[model samples]
Target: MTSVAEWYEKNLMLHRFWSVDDSQVHTEYSSLRSIVVSNFEETIKMPINEPAVGKRKSQIQEYVDYYSGAGV
Candidate 1:
């Protein structure tokens, strides 16, 4: 995905599902890291966060998992 998209997904998309109030702001490519540092940085860099208490499914994760596994 493009940098803009990545930024939006991490911030905007995730925020809708899980945000601390309405302040679901995400970085504009500022949160991104190179592959070499991504693993370490990704851990510390938070996204919008997952819903605190529910079995609610993330549409993005759901579709990706379904389509990717549908070959079976």
Candidate 2:
């Protein structure tokens, strides 16, 4: 999870459109970890997200808007 977040932080172009709050990322990661740990048998193979508050629009929200919904 940490590595994935780090890679996104360094390489994702989404940042160009919206600023990601680092504190939000940390909180999201912690929450995600707790969820994953609690459901060890269930594997999450696709992106699951909610629009996170930030300085600008949320990247996740932008994707949902562009696509009109979530995808697998």
Candidate 3:
């Protein structure tokens, strides 16, 4: 298993973006997307999730509604 520290180093040394090919595109919605990062020592891991499209409202809009106190 690769240590977290090693993973961090590898990420920095080989920076790349994750993307999908146009031919593989689908109309299905993903409710959540996450990005995780850690400290240099790998002692802390911070994971962030943003909303994706859904049947009714997007996750991002829910966050906005909560933060804005719109109660939508």
Find the candidate with the highest TM-score and give its number: 3
Score each candidate by Cα lDDT.
Answer: 0.32, 0.41, 0.46
Once fitted onto the true fold, the runs of candidate 1 whose alpha carbons sit more than 4 angstroms away are: 1-55, 69-72
Q: What digit string (tens of lDDT, one per residue) describes model 1 on residues 1-72? A: 235335655654422222232124223221211111123224433332221222444443354467773121
For model 1, what is the alpha-carbon lDDT of residue 65?
Answer: 67
Task: Rank all candidate structures by their lDDT, best first, as comma-separated numbers.
Answer: 3, 2, 1
Q: Give the range of the ten consecutive residues with the poorest summed lDDT in model 3.
A: 14-23
lDDT value, candidate 2, whole model: 0.41
Among all windows of 10 consecutive residues in model 1, the one with the lowest summed lDDT is 29-38
What TM-score against the true fold does each predicted structure earn? 0.22, 0.36, 0.43
Model 3 Cα lDDT, one tens digit per residue, 13-35 = 42222323313332365355544
State the lDDT of candidate 2 residue by residue for 1-72, as single tens digits: 345434544664222222233453644323112011112233322233455555565566677689998543
**Clashing residue pairs found in predicted model 1:** none
User: For model 2, what is the error of residue 20's alpha carbon versus the real structure, in angstroms, after optimal superposition?
Assistant: 14
Pairs with backbone N, CA or C atoms under 3 Å apart (clashes), candidate 3: none
